[model samples]
Target: MSDPLRETDENVVPQGIDPLRATIRTRFRRGELARAYDWCLEGLKHYPDNLWLKHRAVLCLTRSGALERAQTAYAEFRLHEAHYDAECRALGARLLKSEALEAPLSDFTIQAVRAAEAYAAIYQETCSYYPAINAASLFVLGGQIERAQPYIQAVLEQSENAEQDDREGAYYLHASRAEAFLLRGDMQRAQASLEAAIALDPDNHAARSITLRQLRLLADHLTLDLTGFQALEPPRPAHFAGHLFAVGDGDNQMTALDEEALRVRVREALKTAGVGSLYGSLAAGADILVAEAAHDLGLPFHAVLPTPSRVFFETSVRPVSSDWSRRYDACLEHAASVQEVTSDRKQVGDLHLNYASRIAMGLARIQAAALCTRPLQILLWDGQDNQADRGTAHDARLWRLSGGEQVHLDVPSRVRYRGAGNEGETADTPHFSQSLRAMLFLDVMGSSSVPDDRVPVFVDAVLGRLARACEQFAPGLVYQDSWGDGLFLAFESVARAAEAAVTLRSEFEAIDFEALDLPASLALRIGGHFGPVHEGRDPIQRRQSLFGSQVVTAARIEPMTLPGSIYVSESFAALLALEAEKAYRCEYVGRLKIDSQKQRQPIYSLRRLRRPETSN
Candidate 1:
């Protein structure tokens, strides 16, 4: 039940027609057209009046080269009297214009009858140019260039009147003029008109495709070098004739002996090198025999053991000029050093988003787990505690939802809140269940140097604020997990999550984040997804956690969200609609794929911050 157009099979009736139009423009992208068409038909049987579904089916049929069938289907849709007559008409007109039929079609066959009607209703309708345009296309297709002249001229005059003075229309008009000019061997005017068309729409795929063909033709005629404009760049190697080795208790690891063995392995591996590795991190090596072998073989001897080597010697180097503004600045001073290549790109660049997402997801699971089952508490200890314990306090926090309210119960004093379920049996309750789950997401903004003695204190302050906020709103909301910078929380309802997110933003933004020297201002982007999930009982495995497509999509939404924003799935928004009105902005981000057979589901973004004012 994701997309409204996605209908189940047994609901269909043979008498009903599926009006599915293809939106994917390329044949290569239509791999599942048949399946999509079938699905549309199933949907049509249940909702026979849906124009979009019918239009999509018609488009699919036409694009599959089933033109006659497409024509018939279009007629059927028109007979049913759907609300897409204008669109149907426009597509029909294009097809007729392309084919240039000799006999006039019946009124039902003319798809864009509305456009024709509209034109006639307007001041001074003329069929002279319209028919001539179609006639010229037919003549040109039949290889009768001379006979098409009058038709082409008639179209040019009519187009001038139809286009008025819009710049957007000028290029199309010029394009038609150029085609006629080319047919007549008027190369100068053709070229001029072609240039004008390109100026109007640089990225117009059709124009670009045609322009490329024309350029290639001109290149062939003049015997010119067109290779300079090719899309590919020259290849460069990380190291020339270098030993390719892998460590970690493997035979590939280098030893003090067996020079020949190492040399053979390196040569074998290097033979398979294509563009060389895009990026890599290697360890250092100080073996003299290895170094001597590299020196003798004219190979780059970069360290391959203790990371961050500084050697560079590779064959077939990329050429470069000294000018800084050229395609690539090849100045010797700025070339990648051996050490730079040895630094793992994943460790430095890839982990940021990964850590953040994992933290957010993990926290959401914890909250959900707590809500469905137990009175979970997140005991967060800071640097001060760590320092006092010599970094052994394991600064942790507890978050959970109990009773009908949410709560963030934390450490020190035993703060017990009355939760659902029987009294003594409650402590033994499972962490995850079938109950509704909430989500919590956190974003960290401040970085401060907290000595071992002071770290616990710093963590405590942050946890205290979170704990306080949960208490003020809903009780028993448990801490889910922490991303590198932020935290994730789970709740019983989306309203609770939305309220928590807004409150977190208001509180976090009000803080003096700059007091701690950090790279950038701290910010947050929060998003939540709700659906059926398998909840785990154990805190470690947390199987009761939100899993599969819905969770991943919710995680992705946060990245697309602006800082201090909270985005929810349409399901969550609908659930919240019956409660209090939300102050946040909402948007429909169309349907997204959450799983197989689930598509076009609505996603909503709830904006928390106001648009910023720019200084004049």
Candidate 2:
């Protein structure tokens, strides 16, 4: 079989794209999203089939919050919608606007009604729960409450009959029920249903939006069911005995001898760590090496095949050799669990590779959290820092810098290219690449100004408590470092970081200030934002740390916060909008330009947990 992932030996630039693509890169890195998008769109006009321009333009549109436009571009480019099933979100967003909700006869309501019907058509054809929830939610939104009853009841029936591992869609059903009750003017039942919806899954954006609407419209009268929400059991984190994720260099990067050594190293690492389950992709190099070892050792393998089996075999598996293809096939056939993430990769392009990277890493952590504890990681890479793209070098550095322990094996062949008219090899700069992390900065309100003797003791207690709280939460924080008063943390998900902050706040509030001889209460001012940061060693401290515009932005937001509250940047709030399933999640305070930034960016305050307030 021809290797589909093989790069064409003939290197030719897409016509008229050199200068424009260069300009697009520069503009994109500088945060001129609209300008970059314009340049990319203009380039696309000249080279309509240019994948580079299409992908970049799509990214710009997404960052600029033109999600619908991004979706159109993704469809045009034959790429996955980039967001997880964004058509559903767009449909929900359109139908659930405040005015649309309040008036069944509004023009928006008509448009929403049609959208819901279209979604129902999709459900009829696909039988996926994604559209089913939309079908029912839309009926409720369109004031067809009776029409929603069957869909909601049907979903509940399915949930009751589903296997425990397959009940992922039940959360949407609860949200639909909430919508039904709200439309019928049953406020109390609606609130409880909404609470159940959020409790089931905090990442349900559609449900979260509904809850936020209720809090906004009825805060003076209807208290959010925070009590009920807390009472519901948390999403059980995945756990498995001896599970770990693997990542590293590609086939071309490692020679035959090095492959044997790597395989041995991986086998030893698994055995040494007592890993019984190995989760990663089925890519030809380090991924399969680990898998083969796992197979030999009887470790259950959880695989994420980014593309279809045949496509992956041709593009990713068969590229190296037939031996590799056989191994890949055997691994796939005998894996304990498998997640076919997508089938859109044409040539393992940068975007698709990045997407696969997320799936591989996320499945490792998310599934482990679901079935066991967070999985340990094993990153094998040559010490090269590839700025051109995210690969093993990037993945290894990120895995370690995020405070995930891994058995890192340095291989020489992957260090640099020595073949084909190249001089003696030399690796790129030993720098860790950048990745998006949920950056958090928390400061004890008055730790700096406290008595000199108490400063050390108080700061120690605060940091200790915070660290303990993070471990209690699954997929805990990457605590980069801490000063006398504040600490910096990085996380894979904003939901857990936000939860940790909220929990820590509550824990502190439960402490009596008088018991510690304090004149005032202990409180925390937290600032959180998500962005790309360089995961490298700090020059001054000589320790691994995250540094970038996003990191500094998080720090800038923290001191601006009111004590005892969580202050978040506009970017951070956007993540919450997508991930928070609970009501009273975040409220926009105002826009602040902050130190040196030209744009006045919006900021939001996440409310602390309080007793349900019924009366104003």
Candidate 3:
């Protein structure tokens, strides 16, 4: 049998068929679990009997935090299997372990012990070190250290005789040995084994992340010191920002020599920073140079475009030069992923560009969190502040305000440039008429169900509570209004909007419907977006209001948002990353249709970040 992890060639397969297994495996390996799960489902549509795809589908769902769905999928997968093999049994045990981890305090130990027994049974039947180590770990977590010893010994014994030729296999063996030693209370040997494991495959970020999580669990439960393991996490992710070259300005245009020098400087900065992955735009000048340098260094580059590809290329790339356009195309083609902040073809001043930059920064931060490391911002700046609120200087300021690490590469003195297209503007140039703002739309879930007699109660219990929540954020709240069950709000920043959304959701959930004579089904659905909106006074209400395409976009997202949860547009999530690095988290919930045109928009579930407790 061939190795399932090996890449498959599409040319070798029949025409008109996708290499589904290969596509899914590639996405899975890149840590794109959501996309991998999507591909698995698509593959299943064509080849329903494909066992490998079926198994991977369950794994993707499990890793993506859809435990309930994974459990149901695993059950269906087991029914299709002719026999209960080691892989099948291990997968079932894995699901049980996940559920136990997510279970409430009352049921944690019971569920953990049940999962441990399942793994132990599999280990006894197959003598597999994988199951043996898992059984030991789960047993420990279940508060049965004494019962965990036999399985720990089994793991050490089995791992000693396991083959070490494969890199992945060798890493796992050392990792298993480390876990076994930790279980046995042999801290010295466990540390040694862990060092060996990390040394064997330092670039295995996903594997390192899993090991770190397991170690954290061990440290918390077993009271073991984890200071030495801090350095074993993956390298920091880098966020790149720089000035755009002025194409038509003879005095400010970046020459070939300047371009090459900047590229060299970027390459050195990336290497010195030990960047594992890169996130930025694909604009001309410094952005493309960073992408090219990262690509040459074998680091993954994720492109976050402000607008559609064609429009961005025309405005930001092609106008710079034909050569720059080609370079942009090459970098974009080789990018690990490409995300558009907006589908709009028209550029609205510098709004979209600034939004895209913030999103890129947020994405880098997200990747760093996943790999258990911090994010670094690398700016190729001229060290000069400009009148415009969007550019290298702005980005650097934001990074500093967020208290993130940063490296500045000064632009060559000979290559002075102005803002892209605002060549004749001075420091006194007037700002854009529209300013970036965060807009939120919320709706009461069961408002329509209230009878005439209960209307007063519904308004008092539901709307009254919401009004109180808004009061807490009065400084950040720029505008607010209510019409029946619908509520509209505008905040000065994304961070404030996110905080308010989370607070409203939590407060609404805590409401006692029984005491208030209201239905238990009443809930709140909220959606948010960050963009440039026209701020003016409303004629009908005779009050200040925010109205623009962005406001409309925010309104559309609320209807698609699920009740009792907050869903935000991609731009909103990105800005949250820039403004509040560690205060919130945005999990991608896939693209959802937000309007009648059936045009789908990427949405994320918003939640407050809970700081982890330090182990004593």
Distance (Å) between predicted and true CA of 512, model 3? 3.6
Please tell me which predicted candidate would have the highest lDDT against the true structure. Answer: 3
Give Cα distance to truth, residue 109, candidate 3, Å: 7.2
Cα RMSD, each candidate: 27.4, 18.4, 5.4
Considering lDDT, where higher is better, how would the candidates rank from best to worst?
3, 2, 1
Point out the higher-scoring one by lDDT: 1 or 3: 3
Worst 10 residues of 3 by lDDT: 6-15
Q: What are the per-residue Cα lDDT tens digits for candidate 1 across 53-92?
A: 7776675544333344456667887723543355554456
Clashing pairs in 3: none
lDDT of each: 0.39, 0.55, 0.76
Stretches > 4 Å off in candidate 2: 1-430, 582-584, 607-616
Better of 1 and 2 by lDDT: 2
